[model samples]
Target: MSRYDYRVRRKLFNRGQESSHKDFNSFERKYNQRHRIQRASRFLLILIALIVLIGIAVFAAKADNIKKKSAPLESEKELAHTKNPL
Candidate 1:
């Protein structure tokens, strides 16, 4: 006889009316539209992340190449200084 029983809630709301087929169809359409938008957003997010990662990798490779090109110049300068010894 507690006040939190299911029978009490059902009696108070009279909650046994089934929705019409048209109403159910509208709900399903809205649900499907929202699901498609969510899926597209997820795909776009992944694509953007991949692009950023590829850009970072390309930038890193360029930086490594620049460092490699500079290393020989620095060694040549050292060799010249040693030969002059002044």
Candidate 2:
């Protein structure tokens, strides 16, 4: 074959290989982006659930404290005594 024809064939093969690589690279990038979004959404859901649980625990604790504080204190002698005859 002529030198010019050989050069043209070589350049064409290189371009085809490069295009295939580009196609796979773009596919990988899109897959990674979609996976990252899913991961982010899962993390957000977990974080929100943790926050809600913490809020519920805090509210229950506060309610318990308020109830205890509102109750009248017993006398020292009464505290030591039980509901039985001496």
Candidate 3:
């Protein structure tokens, strides 16, 4: 048989061969815990950034509204001054 055609055999684990399996399970658990913490922190960072952006947008809108309201009052004052010659 050619080397390329030969299949490598996988070792079978018996009931007494549980050490490797337990080690792999512990490693997998630790890896999953670290991955979960990283994902949660990333999500929280994005949430806080979005909240800050929304707050800035709200403040900007309020400032624009204040400017608009003041403009009409100034125009009304000018009209009164011109009509009263003062």
Candidate 4:
């Protein structure tokens, strides 16, 4: 009769608790685990790719320096050959 409904609240609070099965497949939990693994794998892949790219850039820079240092010596050798006329 009053605005309060104790019987209704109690029925809702304890209703069908025992009747529920323990299957608990719980779709959200599986999705969360799968999503976490996917994210971790993607991050790891990106990290490895960045490391490989950095290594390649370092090697390319070193190769350029080596070529630059050798080019001058090659030009000098060519000049020497021209002066010798042989």
Clashing pairs in 2: none
The per-model lDDT (C-alpha) reads 0.82, 0.78, 0.83, 0.80
lDDT of 1 by residue, 1-86 (tens): 86765553435533576634548778999999999999999999999999999999999999877844435577898898899957
Lowest-lDDT window of 10 residues in candidate 4? 7-16
Give the winner by TM-score: 3 or 4: 3
Model 3 Cα RMSD, Å?
Answer: 7.5
- Tell me, by lDDT, which candidate is best: 3
By lDDT, highest first, what's the ranking?
3, 1, 4, 2
Candidate 4 error regions (>4 Å): 1-25, 67-86
Please report, as a residue range, the 10-residue window in candidate 1 with the lowest summed lDDT. Answer: 5-14
Residues 11-80, model 4: lDDT tens digits = 4545647745444566678878999999999999999999999999999999877844435577898888
Ranking by TM-score: 1, 3, 2, 4
Q: What is the C-alpha lDDT profile of model 3 across 1-86, one tens digit per residue?
A: 65687657686456565555568778999999999999999999999999999999999999877844435577898888889954
lDDT of 2: 0.78
Candidate 3's TM-score reads: 0.53
Off by over 4 Å in 3: 1-22, 68-86
The Cα error of candidate 3 at residue 78, in Å, is: 12
Q: Of models 1 and 4, which has the larger lDDT?
A: 1
Candidate 1 error regions (>4 Å): 1-11, 19-22, 67-86
Q: Please name the candidate that would achieve the greatest TM-score relative to the true structure.
A: 1
